[model samples]
Target: MKIKNLSLLVAMMGGAPAIALASGYHFGSQSVSAQGTAFASGAEAADASTIFYNPAGMSRLQGTQFSGGLTFVLPNSDYSDKGSTNYLKRPTGGGDGGSFAPDIVVAPSMYLTHQINDQITAGIGMFVPYGASLDYGGDWVGRYGLTKIDLMTININPSISFKLNDHHSFGFGVSAQYMNAELDKASDAVTGLRMGAAAGAFGPASSAITNLINAGAISGAGTIKIKGNDWGYGFNLGYMYTLDENTRFGIAYRSAISQKLRGSANWDFSGVNMTSAVPGRFRVQSTAG
Candidate 1:
């Protein structure tokens, strides 16, 4: 194998999470070889990913084999001001503005399979099933909505396939996943609303508070940062039927797995504070961010 291949083998051994699903989570990626496709005959290819395809399907392949390739994924995203509410009622309606969206994103993938014997088949797969990203404009009304965002994951599945009859087969697979997340806080718009909102809730402080705010003494908007991650396990079951050399049907089921992402949101005096929070925000604010 090549250096790239070996390096990937090492990483797969680590069981990284994928970037798919809501909140930037993904389950798995596309398969590589035709044999890979044969076993995983349908959208539910998890089992046929190699020895992963119906193990029963492997009994069909006469010898050893290898399959590998890349998958190009184009992800488009948008983070707009559209409509929003200020918990503090700042009277500031977050306005629409220019975007800092990321360029088209392309992700890579691969898979490999081998036939062990009439009773069992062994195989390995390399693919990305999860990921995430962030690209907000500097002038975004919701800059505080989110910043410095990222998503990444890796999974390693070792599986087996077995044949049941002339055209029937069964396969199973187990996966281990590792995950991580990154976040950043945006600056405030106008210090007036951010600082004033504190007083609105308290009923009222004093000119001392106003003076402190005007003197920029109360401290403008504080920066908030968050981060955390988790791991999960799952399995796959699949079946395939052969109609002829060039015809067949496949069905596979993948169990659901849960990942708990834990992270703390914090405020920093030294970091960002947007110019204004937005519209719809009131006494909560006259102006904000």
Candidate 2:
């Protein structure tokens, strides 16, 4: 059998709470070797990446081994306004947002495996399992909906595998994942206008607020920002069966994890006080193969 050399990956992360880039924030660039075939044969366990693809396959590796690689990705995307209208039914005025997504990104991964004995193997892997980023110009029509979003995550996995016989092997592993995110957007123009109007109706004492609004200092067009970080844990199990030297099958399952991302959202419009809590609980499900 020929050992496959894994490739480095460069993957794109599209922005927002819904990770639309690839399979729920998964970059799918963990193995260059796998990428060549679009990950169809990951279960074959032809390289050290088995540490992630199917830990049970680690029992098939000989001696100590290590693999490391990086992927660079360039993403291009734009938003065009097709007659978008604001709350007042007036045309939202702005030019089409240029290519607002990041032009480039780098994703890195590493894995190591050791044979503890004839039937047992141990390994560890570090990689980015999920992430996303997006940015829109301040003048974009959708700026009030979303200006920018960023998410970053990392997973550390330690595993062990045991070969029950020549045909079957089983593996189990645990993961420690850390995630951080930030989001910002322009405040709604209509909401700002309503606040200004309310202040003006409050009589002479509200003159300062009305004056600020007219001067554009409190245009209600400021920004709202939210940021948070959290750590979560999950586990994965795998089973592999070898029908022959050239044919094998594997299955893996990773459990879901819930994280309470404690954070705050702040509105920065002049003369307005606004704040809110965010993400009381967020649950992220794992992938299966």
The per-model lDDT (C-alpha) reads 0.49, 0.67
TM-score of every model? 0.65, 0.75
Among the numbered candidates, top lDDT falls to 2
lDDT of 2: 0.67
lDDT of candidate 1 over 99-207, digit per residue (tens): 4435544445544557676766666555567677665543445544554577776666666777766687777777766566666544342333334444452235434
After TM-score superposition, the amount by which residue 231's alpha carbon in candidate 2 deviates from its true location, in angstroms, is 1.1
Worst 10 residues of 1 by lDDT: 280-289
The residue pairs in collision within model 2 are 7-32, 7-33, 9-70, 9-71, 10-71, 10-72
* Candidate 2 structure quality by residue, lDDT tens digits, 1-289: 1112211100000011122131124677787778779888667776778878888989999999887778777876866678876554667677676887687777789999999999999999999887777777777877766678888888999999999999999999998988887777665533444444453533553565445545555332555566677899999899999988888888998888777665655544442332222112111221111
Let me know the TM-score candidate 2 reaches against the reference structure: 0.75
Per-residue lDDT of 197 in model 1: 44
Stretches of candidate 2 exceeding 4 Å from the true structure:
1-25, 193-220, 270-289
Model 1 lDDT, full chain set: 0.49
Give the candidate number with the greatest TM-score: 2
Shift in Å, residue 80, candidate 2: 1.0
